[model samples]
Target chain A: MDEKDGCGQDGQSTPGVNIMASMEGRGPSCLNVDKDALAGHEKPGFKLCSYVDSFSETHAGRIPIVKSGLGKEDLFSTVYVRWGIRRHDYKVVPGLYGIGHPDRASEVLVTANFKLTFDHLRRALPHISAWILVLDTKGINVWCAAGKGTFSTRELVKRIEACSLEKIVDHKRVIVPQLGATGVSAADVKKQSGFRVVYGPIRAKDIPAFLKNNRTADKPMRQVTFTLYERFVLTPVELKNALKPAFIAALVLFVVSGVGPGGFSFSGAWERGLLAVLALVTGIFSGGFVTPVLLPYIPFREFAAKGIIAGSVFAILLMVAISSAINGMAGFGALFLFSMAISSFLAMNFTGTTPFTSPSGVEKEMKRFIPVQVVALAVSSGLWIYSAF
Target chain B: MKNLRYLDNVSTLVLDDEKCVGCSLCTEVCPHAVFEMAQNRALIVDLNACMECGACVTNCPSGAISVSPGVG
Candidate 1:
């Protein structure tokens, strides 16, 4: 054990738990793999978070013990991840973990290895002592990982055996997050691993209540809600994803607008390009931000239709405010069409982000709306260029 | 999620009540609140709200629920 490692804040560290398994002065030891082999396989300079302050010696092996409190680094990483920075690399070492001096009889809670999900789970278990069995979902959140098939019954069963959970826990029951139910068949898991799967609440925050209520979640805990705050937080990633393409599209429009009867008027390009860029940015916010925030209040079920309405309203307001700057009716028409088409397309793409949209529903809408979006884009491009002359 | 409703009649979720064992796993696993217990048997109360995530189908011990699971 590393002498520098300190136990939890409470000083109630399990007697048999080791501080850390020394590995050539490396700060933290990876319980799943040896340091040499893990270094060769992992991306260069990439290291799992140093949340394991100590280790619990289990019948399976030495398992990392994570504290319930999150440090500054953990909070900062969560913010960075929310903004879509280094998203794919944000994961923890998937294996068994001890929250608060969990023993053989402590409840075993299964979850994905995405660092954010792991953080949330550990953060909620401050007073509760439990053995967390994290499944490797490749940095994806529980719901998305479940839908994508990474957090499947096979993985759960394999992980159970690999961690020697049968020896670690006295009870033959494991609690999986309800969202993971999409991929994990409880019946199959029970049949394969001799462990009964009891699905926990949809959100980590509700876990304490769930456990208190005899491991049964009420209707509120089971349901997934997309609130205004939830929708607001999700918009940054949407904006970041669309920003690059929107920038390129704006640049092309600005350059093409320079072509006139006077042979590339710099003044004309500057004026018209500003208008085109504003329209594009407005479209992005209207569809990517506004539509999502007002998703429930929006009139239509089809995101494209809702986007068109929102974009048109914003475009009309902007044009009316700057009518004197526009050349003619064609200029106004071009800007309106550009904003509408961009917003509609972006909104349609948001189907992938929503929890309630089905693949069949998205496919149905795409088939009906994609051709319309293409036509609008083509006509708007033609009108935008023609009005320049 | 309660106020927000998607396109009507689009989900492919189907429940075979005859095969249901009244285990209530379907109701517990459904995140959209699509399933409801009626006379101790699970029923699809809100088919339109179903996103076809297949949580109910996977958790149903009796194999009464079936849905073509797919991500949007």
Candidate 2:
């Protein structure tokens, strides 16, 4: 979709303009184009459509309307969309949207423009009809966007005024996700737009219970938990992002491993290079996969430290298993250093994805571990090259 | 915040109790429950629990709170 299509900066949609026109020719009926087909579904109360009808448009802009609950189509599309996002299919047009049959009296829930976040919010509120005020967070999730200031008081006020929200909703309150509180000032929002900001539950799933309990969130609902399942689900994207750098490092190791006293030769080079590659891969598994899965069980409070320990253990096991492949003590030392460095670096990258890490903690970790990792890698590379000669 | 705690003495959160009006907005907005209402003013009950997300600082109408963003 063109960036300006759904809601113009001035809060207006060019009437009758089909925003889904671009998406129409792309695929089959999975697009859910026909309004009649959407409304005629087996799901009686819910409805889905790609384009916003004239009835839902306001002076501010048009709001895309969709079914309240998650259907088979929504789940299927979500999986594919999440995969696409890893490949950088970002830029979902930002604006207000309607979930179920929302009216002015319905609760107004605020969220970021990231499509995955939007989908999660809408899907969570299956039975309740609500107005979702999506801020232009540059397609970032609420937490990170709030930290970046994209989901700030200024953007909230601008979007509210632009959407002419006062005219549509009878209430002056807007429910904001708890994670966005860092960026949104309730007092400032009240002063600027006369709308009171109510902080909601930390997780979308808790919204139903929260709303049912008269918008009062319990301690559990307010808290953010990073369970094993949550950590596991995030590993795929982390692994995908790390692939290019890992490949480059492996390639460098392969070439460097080929150098020997007699100069580069295919026979000895392949054996050494293959061993180096195996060690590197083992490090990646320990750092990227094992550390995250065993985060709570890991002995160290620092992620890098945990990674180093895990990598060292793996390196020791590998060395013991393939002692015959080693040329000298230098080979074992190089392998140990190489694995530890790789694991430490990869585990540090996970700090951003984890809930336990704070920005201050991350900064401290980077300062303490980055130099150590650099020295370790440098020493390991030197040893590998020296051993070859 | 309830069952989990990261490194201690790392959060860059600062609260000026003299300027605080005890609105409890910080307590309400903080996902980690870093603040508590004591007497008429908000107190930093669990300073180490803070993730330094700046939610309390932003919501404080009296400019009583300050946290260096991106410092964790």
Candidate 3:
């Protein structure tokens, strides 16, 4: 349910007009709409809307007129999804959507149907009038969808024909996000469909300036950059993804640490097991969180190497802090190897998140370092068991 | 991007001059500014910077560009 921040405009008596419309497949995709919006209904003063003010009857049947201003519900859901919760299911129906009083000459912007991406696009179009053509990316964002081929030339052509785009817009151009260039071939789309695909700015926030400058994006708009805040925002999702695997590894370590010369001891498991868990947590934190934040500063082109550097530094510091508690030299060596291997592996996984890492580069790095990581893991496990006995 | 460079000399991207009709779509779509227009023909200006996103390969009408695309 959305807050009463102009969402209840025109004093509409219907309790959940917009929610009902989307539920019946008249509006854009909202897979998670029923869970929250349906629960909010039947309560007094509760207005549940999917940012749709009304549907405009157009050549493309019932194009939903989305509100340019994002409500509190929209903001809340965005934060929730950022932590990787319901991320796969968070999307809207792919179709034609209108904002403001768009005419035949208005520019048509193309984007994926991922709810967060859709929200960003709509929020950026406050005072502007435009038509949004949402492509079915299966809940994936523009960059990822494009890379995966869901936001392909095929899909673009299909959507244009299916929505009767030629009849709705007088112009021959449709502006697609620059990152979408990976999947969408402009020339192919122009050949297949009459609409000429114009590559827009990389970010949705630059839409106003891009339109003002005659639909041509400058160098900065076309290029991708990973700033501090951008790197920071991605860490939470990385940590969240590492959570389950880290827990399982910790459980395995605890059980393995219980094996000794005399018998399996719960006291030894509680002691050495906790030490192993600590080492694993240190590895995850260093690789997943620290490595990403300090990516540019890390002294290696390979992400695995960068992660090893980060993990080694943290492991040394941790070892020094708990040197008195450590059983012996073997224990210290085991912790160092264990943390470095885990960190390096996690850091290698981060290549997919970065914009500039080529698949070939990643494959090369993986082949070079995976063997080392495997050996380190094996050696560390042996040392930990030997130290336990 | 200059500071955040990836692995050196690893990209499989190659441009075929004979196939090129030179529409300049590659220059427009490449996020790394890898392509440049010279005498109505697109040339690779910074090959190392190229992340092999295949924006050029797919968008190139003449089949001038080719790269086996995949996320790193």
**Top TM-score hit:** 3
Residue lDDT tens for model 1, A163-254:
99999989999999999999999999999999999989999989989888999888899999888998888888998999899889988878
- Highest-lDDT candidate: 3
**What TM-score does each prediction get for chain A alone?**
0.86, 0.83, 0.87
User: What local lDDT score does residue A112 receive in model 2, on the 0 to 100 scale?
Assistant: 91
Rank candidates by lDDT, best first.
Answer: 3, 1, 2
Question: Which tens-of-lDDT digit does each residue in A1-389 have in candidate 2?
Answer: 23333322212322212222223342223233444434424366754444332235544555667544333434556676544444244435676777657887788999998767876786577567788889999888899899899999999999998888987788999999999998998999999999999999999989889888998888878777888888887887777777889899888877888888888877667889889998898889889988888788877778899899888988898899888988888888998899888888888888888866778888888899999999999899889878776
Worst 10 residues of 2 chain A by lDDT: A7-16
Interface RMSD of each: 1.9, 2.0, 1.8
DockQ, per model, reads 0.70, 0.64, 0.70
Model 3 Cα lDDT, one tens digit per residue, A130-158: 99999999999999999889999999999
Regions of model 1 farther than 4 Å from truth = A1-48, A262-267, B69-72
TM-score of chain B of each: 0.88, 0.89, 0.90
- CA-based DockQ, model 2: 0.64
- Model 2 residue B29 CA deviation (Å) reads 1.4
